[model samples]
Target: MAEKVLMKGNEAIAEAAIAAGCRHYFGYPITPQTEIAAYMAKRMPKIGGVFLQAESEVSAVNMVIGAASAGVRVMTSSSSPGISLKSEGLSYMAGCDLPALIVNVQRGGPGLGGIQPSQSDYFQATRGGGHGDYHMLVLAPNSVQEMAQLTIQGFALAEKYRMPCMLLADGTMGQMMEPVELPDSAPEMAEKPWALTGTGLSRKHNIINSLSLTPDELERWNIDRYARYAKVEADEVMYEEYLTEDADVCVVGYGIAARVARNAVNAARAKGIKAGMFRPITLWPFPKAALNKLATTCRAFISVELSMGQLIEDVELAIRCSRPVTLCNRTGGMIPSPEQVLASIEEAAAKLN
Candidate 1:
């Protein structure tokens, strides 16, 4: 049997990145997510991989862009404020069609907010974080184990789509410790024929860029990218439907909040409420089809979140007004209690009476 070791979520993610063939890690120090960089700094040199502590989050993300363009697997991590600083670089990577992994171990924020857990970066991750019509592949993990698993998978998804993939984790998930089994070997990387490695008389030099000075050229690029996004939406939507098949009250959540809602759902079921949870594993894809199917049978929805009701909008949009959606959440680093989510579920069920 594979050994299961206790590890912090941040450390687990760093080890997982290495296991995913990520040879370069560029990051600046930030709370909640600093451990990921620390782990990389400790291990990357020993493994012959690069670990660069950049001057700022912006610099770190750009460093990832440069390394990724050179046909190497690379990653960067930060918290909410740091992610905000890296937004421009993220957009640029999307435009250039670079495959890279980004981890935002989220903290409370609008500005330089608290160093505690928060899910407020949902908008930044699910929507286009920076300018233009682009979306990063976003994965939300509910546990420390899933943090490692998703980090491994996120790298594959990014390489598959030739886009940046983000693990949208909260500070609690980053700092929390749990048992996880490490991968025995790194996943093999696919060749990047278009990578900007030196051609050296074998072939023509490759140019990796997101710039087009001509209007028509830029329009064509945008259209082509949108077509790829449409394909991604079709093929990559992922979710977990817990007791939703016969549910009357559907509770929607993701990441740490999903873990909380799972317990609330069990409690609701014990109390004779037909409660369930729909967890969005892939946030950008949003699991709309599954939610729409359940909306046909469910009476109401309760969105459990660790932010000021950020996931509620997506839930409402997914159900398309077929069922009323209620918000149960806490913001500014406060985690929602299972009892609070259970109360929301019961209240939604009572609305039918």
Candidate 2:
């Protein structure tokens, strides 16, 4: 039986991770996401799991790497600046092909910008934050409900692909309260044949390292990883479309901004305007095909965001510049209102008329 519970997104993420059998969590407390660490600190010990408050984000990510290398499901989380610190570790995990979950409850900034919701980390996440060519299977949630769902999915995808997966959220999604049904079909984690959990049969010792001294070997490794990434792109694109049939205007966004765009779409529909929403759930895989299809039907596309038009570039590229793509956004902890989005939609509709 599935139980319905009202929870903040952060609480739901922690609870869902526990239910998914995550036994280790290491993180440093940060704004809009501290509740996750706090929740785990209180609950992990009771459940016979490990929770450590590391000294810094770098240390926290390294701790997760250590736990994951031991063949256990492990995780850590942070906001923008902290995520920046964890980039080195993230690349290490990706390079070594460690299965771990990382959550970014995004806030504004290139620096310690603000403790408000922002999608400024889109490029950082999709581009693989640190260095080297790698990608984190990134999931974006439009609601608190989806936030819980994606956290669990992040772990699954990470383990399945032997890569780090990220739950890319924002302060709005993290703090919003919503009713969610926990997953009923939780699978038991399979034995990790590759994990270095002190192999009993010492046929050969194991090592997990991101460093490659030789150029030829490193090039081959990069090629192999890109092959894996290609498979991921082909197999993993998730998104949602609302009233897209014969639409004249398409609103593209994710997380909190996407939810606001939903309302704006409905309002525009009420006014007899053909409006729709194209929300990307997997931010890295980024529903390009859907956006292209919508571009064929809609006269214009509006890339609504909580940051200054970061996702707008992707939307334009996906549609191949066949139609005009406009940007509607706010920055530095400010949330664009539904009315404001509706006005943007109205303006776009006028451009078509």
lDDT leader: 1
Clashing pairs in 2: none
TM-score of each: 0.98, 0.97
Lowest-sum lDDT 10-residue window in model 2: 184-193
lDDT of 2 by residue, 109-132 (tens): 979999989998999998878988
lDDT of 1 at 133: 82
Clashes of 1: 0
In terms of TM-score, the best-performing candidate is 1
In the range 1-353, model 1's lDDT, one tens digit per residue, is 64998999999999999988787999999999999999999999999999999988888999999999998999999999999999999999999999999999999988998999999999989887899889999999998989999999898889888999999999999999999998877766877898988988989889998989999999999899889988999999989999998999999999999999999999999999999999999998888888898888988999888888788999989888788988999998999999999999999999988
What are the clash counts of all predictions, listed in order?
0, 0
Q: What lDDT score is found at residue 227 in candidate 1?
A: 91
